[model samples]
Target: MTAAAPSATMRLIEASTMISQGAEAKIYRARLHPPAASSPSDPSAPDGCVLLKHRFAKQYRHPTLDGALTRARVAGEARALVRCLRAGVRVPGVRMVDAAAGVLGIEWVDGASVRALLGGGAEGEVEVEERDDGEEEEGEEEAHEDGAEVALREYGLTPDQVMEMIGAELAKMHRADVVHGDLTTSNMMLRRPSAAQPAAELVLIDFGLAYISTLPEDKAVDLYVLERAFASTHPQSEPLFAGVLNAYAKGMGKDWTPVSRRLDDVRLRGRKRSMVG
Candidate 1:
């Protein structure tokens, strides 16, 4: 299926700031409409700020078929977000959807991705201002420039605390029976603490690959996916991941044992596949 570019979409793109792009979609930091006054406006006022994910239309398929599939996928993501929200899982609220144009707009999260916070490279981060030519780019090394401890202190967090948040949040999401098919630190954000909201909250983003599943196997795989992501993204991350699992287990209550056993099995399969490849 294919979608003819809408003029409105083009205008939105022109006014919005593109933050990242993937094979499936392009993300933008955009406001639904212009600020009431260009001069100055209330910071607390709702400006319809959103993180827009625009799914590119497939050109290989018939227009009718592609349009239907695109709409279904967009709707699926929105439904998943709603499910997570109802289950008390922290996630961006769906703001608007234009299935015909394959666009899904969600609440703008004001913070940094967990990966960036944990010293993972921020390849597509949106910065508030451009640094001067002499400034160094912030990355894994930059995050730890002073010291890991000092870094965490700046954010009022410890490595273990972040891990616990990750694990508990995943369990909450799983309890709601929503499988985040692609679980990674980059997909999780740490909302900056403010005077109004003193506690930093973790918010899950990107439901493009999320789906509903009651199966324990799916949940286990979700954990396994995150495990690998942690291993590859952070140094000496095994202990951190273990902490996450512990928190996850506690959050799961009676639902932990089965998923834990399944996770072990998934890990074994992953090892075997790696050796085979």
Candidate 2:
């Protein structure tokens, strides 16, 4: 879907910081403080922050079709996120939804994208940790002089652990019947829970291409796509992907057998279904 460039009319009022931009949407970190309800007991929600994803219209597509497509995707993404949240999966909560304007606002999560966390060659200080004073702490590690290989070390996770998180999260998503059509590390994020919490949280984001599916083949294809992504991006990915599947299998329990076999067949035939006569 083609979305138009962001408009001031549609722009989020309190989005003071621009986080990232891609072909389809622009992400902004913003605070959303809605008016208090009639009840005095309803305490004001102070500085309720969120991520505003504005799906800008694409100039490439016809105007009529573009608007319709953009609106649909925005709505779909918001719905998918809500579905995952209700299923006990770790996804940002939907703070607001404006389907007509092609905007899906979600709770702003403080964390690093799985891509940035894994491919850590980024230059400059990174906001890796938060302090008690409400300031983000920068990573003090020196930049890798090797360039490309530097970022790989920033993830703080071994390849095996990364794979396990991927596997377990995907299994939960699939079991809940959510199919993330784009299953890449870039779409996931790793965030440390609040100071009260210890273990890190794996959050699945960007559900623009997500849908609900119960088919074993669909689930298998999701894993296949992720496996290919890891192999292409990271060196020595076999063991890593194996670890992912181990976690997935454990999460899927009895439902994993069929999907595992299907994945093996998919690997042999390649990502596409054969169209031969």
RMSD (Å) of each candidate, 1 decimal: 6.7, 10.1
Candidate 1 per-residue C-alpha lDDT over 72-132 given as tens digits, one digit per residue, 9 for 90 to 100? 9999999999999999999999888887788888998888788877766675443223368
Clashes of 2: 8
Which pairs clash inside model 1? 1-66
TM-score for each model: 0.84, 0.74
Q: Write the per-residue lDDT of candidate 2 for residues 1-277, one digit (tens) a residue.
A: 8987666536564334676788888887666655345424322222356778878788999989999998889888988898898888888899888877778888766666766655432323332343798553443222321332343344445546767887888888999999999987777887754555456677888899998889888899899888887665543334557888899999999999999898898887784444542
Candidate achieving the largest lDDT? 1
**How well does candidate 2 score on lDDT at residue 157?**
51
RMSD of 1: 6.7
| lDDT of model number 1 | 0.82
